[model samples]
Target: MNFLVVIPARAASTRLPGKPLLDLGGLPMVVRTARQAARSQARRVLVATDDPTIQQTVQAHHIECMLTRPDHATGTDRLAEVTRRLRLPDGDIVVNVQGDEPLIEPTLIDAVAQLLARHTEAAMATCAAPIADAEALFNPNVVKVVCGAGARALYFSRAPIPWARDALADGRKCLASGLPAWHHIGLYAYRAGFLRQFPGLPAGQLEQFESLEQLRALEQGHTILVHTVKHPPTPGIDTAEDLERVRKILAQAVTAPPG
Candidate 1:
């Protein structure tokens, strides 16, 4: 299955300006993300950004980069422009890897891609992991995904779903139940044709309420296959604190060296 990994990057991050260009150890954050994407089973990897600095940084690393409109409301919209400009085939798989996740697992990328390939009926595919922390489960910033039988996403939301009514009566019981609470992973694989048509679809009410683009796809009746990843989802750099966390992770990874 042919796949293209597109990383959407923007310079005007409200929490951290020029975030895509921020240094991650010795390399630019976007370049580090592209490097991880390169490890995936993708046929090609491209960084889509509206900032010239990001484009230059990616090109300096000899990675493919596309200049897109800065006003894109969502990463999917930026990816649409990339697919259009690249003229990818309708059946080709395009994975949207967030640029801020410098530590994104390549195996998860391969898994999502393969899931999309196997489930041709699904217009898109994504990943999720079990949320072990009760706080994270309830935090609106941590999106949750409920999957139906056969791993199809039933819904995506910022609120805790499948709320265990009785468990909430005792906080300790909720954590001890061992019931899996899935946390949404930002990675996504989409058919090139569907990606091209994404921006034209009317934004769904649920999507607006949750502020999750994936919800829009669900509301439009598009099937999204969800692949479960065993590892914890990589922390995406959303602010200075997140950047520091990623730096520590990378530092440990470097010092620990594979056994």
Candidate 2:
């Protein structure tokens, strides 16, 4: 099945304003992300943004982009606007690639989209990585996912799930041996029809309480298939520190001699 990648890049980030236009190894960050998405199996990649500067930057790189409304509540809403404007077929696959993720793997993009296609019952697909460190598992900012049989997501939360009660009570402050722990990755793949329907779905108590938009789908009785990635994704840009880190990584890549 063919896939269309829609990258939502809003300029008004609270933490890192004007992020899409920020330079990453000479190219704008959004453009770098688009370039990565272009490397995927997707038939087409489009950058959706409300900022004209971002749109112009993406277009200057000769990549397709569309200016969307600035009032969109979330990135998914922005992608929905793109889907409706493009008149994408209901059966077509649409992947929501975050604009900040310049280091996102193209293969992971393909993996999530293919997972969605293979699971007819699921409305969306996402990737997760096993939590290797105790600090990450306990970090509230690190979203955790619980998956049941056949990789169907049972729940997602900011708190450590299936809590290691025994270890915690003993003040071990470490992950229990033989216990499973997974952290949520922000990437997503969705059916075009569902993408259009997402904004209309009722906000559920779990979603509102947790501030996780994906919970709305689960509350509405839609299945989300969670697949594991062999490696965790390089962190996306969110704050000033994140930007500096990515810039340094890019610089190292540029100077590294190819064997």
Candidate 3:
């Protein structure tokens, strides 16, 4: 399945300003993310940005970049504009890879795209991994997903879902038997047609409350296929601390001896 990986990079980050231009190892963070996506099976990789500086930086690396309007409310909105500007075919697959995820796994990208291709009835696809600890299960920053039979996401929330009613009431820290908690990974695969239509969909109440754009699709009765990744996702840069952690991790990997 041929697909285009669009990395929506905005220069204005509330926590870390000029985040896309920040240095990651030797390359700019946005460039590093684009390079990582390039290793995927995507037919093309493009960075959609609203800042001239970001566009120039991406161009300096000889990577394709598109300048989009700065007013887009969300990354999905930015991607919709890209689909129109480039006039991608309706059936073409477009994967939304976050600009901050420089360590994103290429195979996971391929897997999500393939999952969408296999589920011809679904309009979008994403991935999730099993939550290993109680702390993450209760962490609001960690989005959790509840899936129905055949890997269809029933709901996504910041709260611990599929709540272990009896167990929790009993003051138990464990989850109910057979109910596995999974954390949602912020990656998505969409058909170009759905992506173009996304902006027009009414903002969903659930989406507004959860601050999750994907809920708009769910609220509109669209199906989202969820696939489980073989390996856990590497951390994405979100704050100054996250950036430093990833930098040290990457640096260590580079200096480590060949085993």
Candidate 4:
């Protein structure tokens, strides 16, 4: 299925300033992300950003970039402006790839888009992976998603969902059984029509409390299909440490002997 990819990049990241422009193996972080997105089956890929420098940098690399309003409250809002500018059809699938994920897998991007294409009842689609350890399950930074029957997403939050009542009350450091805990991946596949209406939707109480944008759709009675992957992709850059880790991984990749 053909789809459009929009990478939302902001110059002012709270944890890491000028994050999209930061270097990753000699290329800007946003540029690296766009390269990965280009590898996907997406018919077109565009970088939507608020900074002139970032737009110039992306264009310098021969990548498409759109300079959007800097006052966007969220990346999704920035993407809405892009849909309006492009005039994407209501049925067109638009995958929202986070600008920070330079290591994002192209295959996974295709998978999410394909998943959304098959689910007509859903307004949006996202990915999730099994939570491996108690530490990650407990960490609020790792967003979790609970999916009901038919892979319909019931909720998304920073809290440990599908809470193991017995395990937690027993003071055991173990993950829940029967129903596996899942880590919500930031990647998303949105219908162009839904994306355009996103900014106008009133912020949901659950979304504001947990700082998750997906909750707003749930609150508005929209169905979100959750696609589960067995293994999670490499973590995206969120802080200085994450950036350093990705650099080392790229360095190792460059030097390692090809099998």
Candidate 5:
């Protein structure tokens, strides 16, 4: 179960500027994410950021922080830099815990890393949860994943997949009693070796149209295992409203009487 966890905290965010520094329960957002990662069984947890302020804030709490190049196009690229800089072995596992997920479950982190370990043939592993309703199934914003044979992802899209043909035919708006669909989670676990080579993979045609990074791997013919979970953890924070929601959730947890 030994693995490394890296929280990528870029300074700039279009929706929420200075997001890594936003306050969450008295701690910076990225710091809160690092704390969650630390609670996991990871052998090592570090914050990979592009801001010195973020670096100093994380280090102040005794968390390991590495300042990476800000120009990397995607979070995956940032993770690749960490792997190369640390010289992690090919077999080592690296979990990319998004910096905005302060409430992310530690168990989920272990699960994803273990998923990759169990599926040696897979270059990457990610989580997904069942789509319970047609509303969720059809929401373009809710990325859907279809699982293929051997627990690998057949495809991922913002559009609803599997068609649910007979059940949703005739413009029906409700999901069938037992429709099979999955909501893709952003979390990912990669073999350090694969991460080093990921950035060089050509941009995928589907990836360009959908703007989903995972598609790049699928398009490149790399195997990505889909680890289905009963329920997804609280999503990452993206806007002022999301920040307040998490703050309130944390506040309630603090004030609630012990069970």
Candidate 6:
């Protein structure tokens, strides 16, 4: 299956202005993200942004860059614009790699792409990992995904889902035995044609309430296939603290000798 990776990068981040260009070790954050995507099996990786600075930076690294409208309401909208502008084939797969995730694993990208290829009925595919850390499961910032049989996403929420309603009263486990609670990974893969139509869909109430774009697709009755990955969720760079944490992780990885 033909696969393309589109990264949505906006310079006007309220929390961290010029976030895509922010230094991540020796490279800009967006550049780091592009490098990770390049490692994947994607046939092409393009950075979609309205900022000239981001375009220049990405182009300087010899990465493909598409200048999109600045008024895009969401990253998904930006990606839709890229798909239309490029005239990508209807059957092609486009992976939406968040520009902030510099440490995104290439294997996870491959997994989501494979899931999309295997499931013809699924319009989109994403990944999730078991929430081993109790603290992370409760973190509102860590989006959780509940998946049903055949890898269909049941729902996504910031609140702990499959809540053990009777944990206190009946002392019974909320989730069925052997069922794992999953933490949603931001990475997404979309069928090119489906992605083109995404912008026209009405935004759903749950999407607005949770501020999760994926929910819009779910509410629209689009099936999203969710794949489980064994790897721990890598932290994305969203704020100064997140940047520092990523830097530390990268530094340690660099210093460690190859096995």
TM-score of every prediction relative to native: 0.94, 0.97, 0.97, 0.97, 0.97, 0.93
Off by over 4 Å in 4: none
* TM-score comparison, 1 vs 5, better candidate: 5
Q: Rate the local accuracy (lDDT) of all candidates.
A: 0.88, 0.92, 0.93, 0.92, 0.92, 0.88
| Candidate 3 per-residue lDDT over residues 130-203, each given as its tens digit | 88777788789999999999899999999988798887785667655666898999999999999999999999
Give one digit per residue, the lDDT tens place, for model 6 in 78-179: 999998988988778999999999999887898899899988888999988888765666788989999999999989999877574554246433444444
RMSD of each: 1.8, 1.1, 1.2, 1.1, 1.0, 2.2
Better of 4 and 5 by lDDT: 4
Candidate 5, residues 1-117, lDDT tens digits: the string is: 899999998888899999988988899988888998889999999999888989999999999999999899999999999999999999899999999999999999999999899
- Of 1 and 4, the candidate ranking higher by lDDT: 4
Report the error of model 2 at residue 246, Å.
1.1
lDDT of 1 by residue, 98-206 (tens): 9998888888999999999998899999999888878888889988999899999999889787688778765543443666689988889999999999999999888
Error of 1 at 125 (Å): 0.6
Q: lDDT of candidate 2?
A: 0.92
| Model 5, residue 52: C-alpha shift (Å) | 0.9
